[model samples]
Target: MTRGTGRGGSSAAARSVDVARLAGVSQKTVSRVFNDEPYVSSDVRRRVLEAAGQLGYRRNNAARALASGRTRSIGVVTLGTALYGPASLLMGVERIVRDTGYALRVVNTMEGDAAGVAGAVGSLLDQGVDGIVISEPIDEAGDGVDAPLRVDVPVLVIGAPSPVTAPTVLTAGDGADLMARAATEHLLALGHATVHHLAGPQGWYAARDRLEGWRATLTAHGRDVPPVVTGDWSAASGYRAGRELAADPDVTAVFAANDDMAIGLIRALAEAGRRVPQDVSVVGFDDVPVAAYVTPPLTTVRQLFDAVAQEGLKRLVHTIENPDADPLPSSGPPVDLVIRASTAPPPSRTTPARGRRPASPSPADTPRPPLTNGGPAGDH
Candidate 1:
């Protein structure tokens, strides 16, 4: 046995046969003992164990994993898009996995379809994975897709909007609600007549939450709640919605469902000769990478999506590893309003639509309630 740093902090010299000589055994016997191969007598095994302990020997895990089928690895299935949220989450998970003596194998599954995800998991199981992770939120698809709720081993669901019934982690709520409330509240704070919304697809969880927030806020403030104008989560749809809203001339403050729609809204407003922050104020959600880089630098809700993703991953991993452990407490991320060059007071010429009964504000508008561990996706 020898101990000291050498090249790359290895042995100070080549392993000497002194331990074998001291233990009164052949060097091959010493090697077999280290390998834990059978057939060595109990006495010789005891002698070899003592000698190795004195030598300060450390078994190399990488070499051992190579020889043994156990890799202590977890497989992660992700949406291949590498969008902001998913991409950021991967970084966070890697940071933790690096030190845990566990390996992570990433498999890209497109849009988290049931088949794609299941196949990815199947591949990992074939590779002798100890556990698996699914990083799809079932976003805006409104639980429209199918997926496995259980697996033979642990299955962690990350990037989910609510805590999944099976072991999982997720963002606080549908998130769109917070964003909608913030955007509308910001406008109300500015003393706009009422805030109008250009919504995303109805099936999307985000779209539904945002609309709910808008309605709840309006109904609480003694304001009229107008019907939501639909969008396909695209700039074009928002542009179309904007054109119609612009026709009214009273759509003073508008909250588009996301930044991309906000861009379209701005373009439509400008096309109609309406000036931003002067004629119409628009607020958007997500504050995507391009939000600030746009022409006027959008005023939007700034969500810690990457942080959300990272936290969700952590929670899912914990739940997967120890399902019986106490549930984690949420840090409760705040949704902030970014006051940029885009939002301002309403135009003087704006007029209210006639004959609509005004709505009274509710608790969802002011002192808004937080999403309280809304149990997992599909529970609804």
Candidate 2:
């Protein structure tokens, strides 16, 4: 037999004709199955799919786009870093986009500021994507020179709401302010007179939101808000901030913006001979995979990234299909606070005199009960 005449072979490449012939159906039926058009019976759809698989048939996306006058693809712009938040958001977008039978093209800003973001979006436009999603746009350099992105295509932003005219979606339900408030209040509820914050870098919208949340909670409760120590969302930065906090005897409780920084802060406290939940307590944001398995399980706020991605994708697709309809801003997904072993009431005694070391707490003084699953001890 000739090469093209074999059981699953074709003259050139497998096409709808081959699928239809092998499945004993008309070419139109095969087309309906591939296009997901209604009216194809279940048995015929299953037969067409099975035959396509057997014949190694792949849909001609380019041809479909040309005929339909639409590119079934989306462009995603995000930060270059592999930080958990950005990475997770990208994964979620990819999954949802694929489920909806669209292709995803991604561009990274390579740690640049607003200019980099503008460039990334421009590149996606050149590639002819149906829609664009900007994940975690940062204003690090703070040079307001970059103009707002102007695009004819639908645009969705995944970070904090911006001045850009595009409809924005927050990945977290409560935004940073509420999350920070929740974390700080958790520490205060444990009887810590005040809460110190180790914030994320200034450029990140997430960082700023968290700081705002922490400050607002402190102010509302009439608690002292210490000077903010900023970190690049890295454990090393947290360690550095922790070392400085370790020196101050007045430091009783700390809230790091992410779990990596929290881990670093805990290590620094340990090195300085301060026991967690004894001499000091630490809480972190982002309940990362290792948060629960750490030496002292982290008390953290968990944002539902998958839910955010799904909701954002749904909204973007709706906008793409109904261009004339007004796009409603989404409030995003809510966050949960998971109370673990890493926090407790402040030391029983007042802050020791500046230079004098505080007495170590006895076992009785540090009563660490089993960690609670998902609620704060009380309203701050």
Candidate 3:
């Protein structure tokens, strides 16, 4: 066997030939084993792997790609934020891509416009990605945006419903429609006369879906739909909305678009002398890690990000392998409503005294007690 003469005269970078010689098998067998191609006997595959490990042999992906005319890498275009939803989706995609023996290249686009998406896609194509995943497409109107949809490779868009030039997958089930209904219904069932919404910023598909769901549910139940208080998915925005809602003695139940805003709302309500669950019940979407640890563990809608990622990755891979296959619309995993200390029945009275502490409820009229700290009620 020939030894590599580069750097300290150490032959640590062994080639497939070296593994083949050591295992008494052909180099093609070693290649097949490393590539995970079928038709090689199990015993031979084991021998090749063991020999490669012993010889410190690594497969040359560059050479393989050159021969195959394809790069085993996928590109991901995502927003440039550390927010939980986008971050979780990226992590999920990364896990699946790594497991499937493909490397992931991520590009963060600050803008959510057509030019921004086009630039990101152009960069990925320049880098020779086999396929692309638009992890989060920004469609503020609930209606799909006309961003550059022209791509030669298979593309999977996460969280887009319309303008289906390519296969799309939503990270949350039924967009925000399912979650809003679940949260609104929960509060209504708890005997709240009406539910108010702390909505995400206008133009966000999520915000639009959630607002529509809330309005639809309220209308369906023959209740009046209150005006939405808009937020930028920030705690500060939620606090501002909370202050506005707190001033109105009639606001008893509030569903914030996300947990961050819900936390802010809680703080604002507390400052305004309105006790959560006792005076005004609050619900949030996205059961983030801190949801359960908050003072009054949050009642929220849980989105299965990992499951959505898995399904999206599966479809993208299938498309990449079978380019001629017809594209199909994909739905995301179901959402669950997690009840905690943050939500309860409305106070017995119609309206509380504005800017004054609400009266304590009598024992018989008390709503269900808050769950124990750090313990969440079972998923609905």
For candidate 2, lDDT tens digit of each residue in 1-380? 11134373435577889889999999999988987788999999999999888777878888889997779899998888889988887888899999877889999887755467778888998999988888854774575554566777777778655424454332323366777787887787667889999999887888888999999999999988789999999999999999999999999999899999999999999999988877888889878888887877778887678888888888888788667786647763465778876886787653467798867555464443232245433221
Query: How displaced is residue 320 in candidate 3, in Å?
Result: 0.8
Name the regions of candidate 1 deviating beyond 4 angstroms: 1-5, 8-72, 82-102, 111-114, 128-131, 139-148, 152-174, 317-324, 349-380
Checking candidate 1 for backbone clashes, the offending pairs are: 140-204, 140-205, 163-376, 164-376, 219-360, 219-361, 220-360, 220-361, 220-362, 221-361
Off by over 4 Å in 2: 1-12, 17-48, 141-146, 163-174, 325-332, 349-380
Root mean square deviation (Cα) for candidate 3 = 5.4
- Pairs that clash in candidate 3: 140-203, 140-204
- TM-score versus the correct structure, for each prediction: 0.65, 0.81, 0.81
- In model 2, state the lDDT of residue 19: 86
Q: For candidate 2, list the clashing residue pairs, or say none.
A: 173-333, 173-334
lDDT (CA) for every model shown? 0.67, 0.79, 0.78
lDDT string for model 3 (1-380, tens) is: 33443335665568888889888999888888887788999999989988877766777778889998889899998877787777887888899899777889999877446456667888998999988888654653244545545667777777755333444222323466877888888888778999999998766667878899999999999999988899988889899999999999999999998999999999999999998877899999888888887868888888778888887787787677667786445764475777787776677763476887756555355343232122445333
Ranking by TM-score: 2, 3, 1
